[model samples]
Target: MTTNEHINSGEWPLWEIFIRSRQGLDHKHVGSLHAVDAQMAIENARDVYTRRMEGVSIWVVESKHIHASNPADAEAFYDPANDKAYRHPTFYNLPDELKHM
Candidate 1:
């Protein structure tokens, strides 16, 4: 069946795939796939997006479960943080013993 036909058939749910290449790294969205369930989605994502074993971990989330802010309201929602200079650490004076920080 064509891609559109398969999607419209409702036989599979769309999943968003995220991969972490190594330990301590954040999982980044790579792509998406369609599957019958979460386990199948995870397996399919690993196979499709990590053929060369680039990822040490994978996460598959149903597209329907994700909620995101509208891009148009980004400035109104996030711009307020930019005006708060005290939230930053530029003025902080750490002790000499805190060299790692």
Candidate 2:
């Protein structure tokens, strides 16, 4: 089948996999793969990314479900958030217990 035909067949959907090695760590994007469903995607991710048993957990997200900003709009999209100083804790007077943070 042609690439377009295969893609439009709907039998395979691209999934982005995130893996967390341990409990305290956050899940990081490992790679993408094609799968028929969520369960298949998870299985494929485990096989592809955790061959050495490195990951304790896996999250498979359909690529289409992810909404991301365009790199071209980076400045316009992220500049506002950067100027919000109150979002940072630097303005707060922390107690001795929390000051170490």
Please give each candidate's TM-score.
0.80, 0.73
Alpha carbon lDDT of each predicted model: 0.85, 0.85
Q: What stretches of model 2 exceed 4 Å from their correct place?
A: 1-11, 81-87, 97-100
> Candidate 2 residues 30-50, lDDT tens each?
889988778988999988999
Q: What is candidate 1's TM-score against the reference?
A: 0.80
Q: After superposition, how far is residue 71 of candidate 1 from its true place, in Å?
A: 1.2
Instruction: Determine which window of 10 residues in candidate 1 has minimal summed lDDT.
Output: 1-10
